[model samples]
Target: MFFVILLAQTVIGQKITGTVYDDTKTPLPGANVYVKGTSKGTTTDFDGKYEIEIDAKHQVLVFSFIGYKTKEVKVKGKTIVNVTLEQDSATLDEVVVVGMAESRMMKREHVVGYSIARIPQNTESYAAIKENDFKDVIKNPLSTFSVDVDKASYSNVRRYINNGGLPPADAVRIEEMINYFNYDYKAPKDDAPFSINTELSACPWNKDNLLLHVGLQGKKIPMDDLPPSNIVFLLDVSGSMNSPNKLPLLKSSLKLLLESLRPKDRVAIVVYAGSSGLVLPSTSCKDKKTIIEALEGLSAGGSTAGGEGLKLAYKIANENFIKKGNNRIVMATDGDFNVGLSSNSEMERLITEEREKGIAISVLGFGMGNYKDDKMEIIADKGNGNYAYIDNLLEARKVLVSEFGGTMYTIAKDVKFQLEFNPVHVSKYRLVGYENRLLNEEDFEDDTKDAGEIGAGHTVTALYEIIPSKNNSDKENRLRYQTSELTSQALESNDLITLKLRYKKPEKNKSLLIEQSVQNKPVAFTETSDNYRFSASVAEFGMLLRDSKYLGTATWKSAYMLAKDAKGSDEEGYRGEMIRLIKSAELLSSNKQE
Candidate 1:
């Protein structure tokens, strides 16, 4: 009898089991079940079933899932403790507001005397954008701007279209839309990090203007040859992220990335809600199971302390920094920072400071309605990193798995492009996009001026619309007091523009310059390569969505046909998807017009 009692006591201390459910009695798969105050935990399986070993000192079991209030039950010497969590009212209200906004059933700003916190959650979030205007080539000959490789806007807009609505104009970033699709540019040949390709063709939208397409292709590095990585996952577990599409999806997305990590790589996890804390210290990729367990145990709650989380994540990344290796922080959030150090400026300053220590920051935006895209974009821009939106598992795979090297490893930094249009060939010109990335003409040659970074196997594209000098109908009159004249050499030259590219090695501060002069070689729009046609289609689509004043004769049907024709060897189906989206948008726009 004494031996039997001792064995039973040992079994009781060794294990505890439970099932977790939401208010509607639906099984909450992926819900976290753990002993309070301890790292020992396990996630509920598909059936909401979980079994975790318990230490004798740990007398309480905690059950948690995003969007549901967390529940803690004292063991009290019980063998089983099933839990049902109530829906968090604040989160439900936010979801309701998002639904109303999507349906256009109500205006969030109609509530009188409402504070920001109390304002209807229906207010969709987007950054303000002012489109670029035409520049007189004689007066403003130099067009300089940083390269932007971020593709968040494309996926975010897709999410809206897929949900049966057109995206807000401010959400449609033309540069990002053009960059999302891969182009068939030539690969780098030598020690240079990337190769540049240029093509000039007649503009499809505006018959009077010509389009100049510039492309950059980064050298590809084999996965086996990639350096060891030191990555810290800065995850937001605040109340705002307590939704099915936020925290839960984020965990699943990170798991896909974990499958790509090698034994030489290391990972750390830092989670923040009302406060910040390190859940897992730096661990080798070989111990993936342990790392995954830590991720599965995380549950969203409380307010967002994003600044605090950023600091802690950067500290962890710095501590485990590897020389000549990929050191970065992958931040997954909805961009809602309501508590401690929540201001955009403060967050930007923190990211900028940390990036100087050689740790890049890649932001993965999730959720909608309350998303702070402006904040996310700025953080990634200043942090020497890239930004992508993960709307679903496929997009997560695209960013975290398929484009691993290009998304995480940097080969070149501070990349800027400057173009000088010759008055002899071009009368007026305007950059198609990159309004926010514009830089001072002098900043192009300044090595200290920060710009965008290029990763392995990455590609950057830019477009310009130019009016020929022969077509002088829109030309401005010469200054009344001063006579503008071109040199004999300029008059004899056939060069339309001189393109100059400046970039620095990932580890060096010195910049390298590459210059190429484009002559008056114009091809018909239909005779252009698939790269030119596809990119032009994307830009035209963006203009139509924004209802830009500059969009002359651009129609959805034309953009759709162009995209379908130029969908070349799209192994990833991204180009095909764009065609379908264009069709959907056309229908939506037509319905609205009716």
Candidate 2:
């Protein structure tokens, strides 16, 4: 009898194995499988096969994948349990709405009324981005662009990689990817809002050219010293946000942010769907339970009236304006604005006008299919605010809790950079990213012109790939009428470039100018600081992803190696995560080739 009992226990301890498939019986790779009610989980391999050890106590298993409905199975003494998840019809119907907008002449009201159970979902959304091209320094000597502190692109790209796919080329914004990782630049010493650091080194991808890295470090503000905040949460509880990863994830994300709020801070809730309404009046942070209940009670329904919601949110913020304190509106949505003032230009005008009234807007993007990335980006850019995409709960914590100061407080506004390359030293150059943020040469000195804003404790980095004047291979043809000779002063100067920065204090209208010159001294790549090396690695990675024509010899292997070596003092493990992401991307690329 003892031997029989031992044999039964051994048989029961065997691992449970199964395959996950879609409705058409096609295997789903990278699907998440785990024991229900626990963190123990494993992802399906390339063949969609998963194995998990089930103990006597854990009898339930859950299977989930992006764009598919989740499935839960009870073991019930079964050894093998296969799951066939149905395509999430809701997301698919929304994809139709995105593509059929003009063809069906469907307005917001008609589209919102379509049932989610109509189709099978298949689509990816990304803002259209036009890459920058190299310019002759002799003709276009100055490069000017606003500083973008938004890190949405980095996390959004990661979401694609983690789901076993490569991000759309336009989605890979190199500057955001590099700025997502904080650098160890020196802090500001005097009354200046930020300090600038510049480094020039031999380009890793092309040994013939040089790479110039410019970094800006914003002054750090301790959490306790931050001003009291008067915040309005503009949430989108529209019908489209009914997915598990949309509304539910947003609620959980906001709760994490609430944990970091102080008693002196006050928050109000404004929701939009069909029409706009105030869900919770301005209440002190000490009333955490009431705020949480308000967030929980929000349900998805009706068409989205994002413009009305924004108007109401700004009105509340203006009413409760905190002098010398942080008065901001946090707009959380999927960026699908279908009602009044839904056009991009109209939304931009609304947010820009409201921002001028001292209430900044920070946009938190959620969801995937039917996501309006272009609209979200424009709203943040025009509203004197920042934008971040919350793809998962962990990213939520990073943006809202870990970097609260940087996300909520604006230290500098209309920050701009203009680099004047010496015609004698550089022949041609290209700014790695910021294609959309480029400013006119005259716009740098215009205080009234809108530009990017830097939050407290935020760091912005920009890179320029330069071809020296001696490199005749990449030079532009000399004009027949104009002289090709450099000026006597340009020939005599030792300066390679002049970096000019213009920024306005958070409340001031006028701008302050700071100028610095960098000498033409290129250091070996290995001797450069970890900040320079790591940023170069990220830029190279982006170029490879974009299939850039300027990518002379950049490869995924080289980028991965460089990033892995220069990951110094990665306290937050963000750098380490980049290394892993590169590996996955490399594998995906190779698989495509095969």
Scored by TM-score, the top model is: 2
TM-score, candidate 2, is: 0.82
Q: Please list all clashing residue pairs in model 2, or write none if there are none.
A: 92-121
All predictions: root-mean-square deviation over Cα? 12.1, 8.9
**Model 1 RMSD vs true structure:** 12.1
Residue by residue across 12-99, what tens digits does model 1's lDDT show? 6667787887664645555556566654556665456788887556677867543345577888677787889774422211211222
Best candidate, lDDT: 1
Q: In model 2, which regions exceed 4 Å deviation?
A: 1-33, 36-55, 59-125, 471-477, 480-485
Whole-model Cα lDDT of every candidate shown, in order: 0.83, 0.82
Which pairs clash in model 1? Answer: none
* lDDT tens digits by residue: candidate 2, 101-140: 3234233323321333433353545677788888888789
> Backbone clashes in each candidate structure, one number apiece?
0, 1
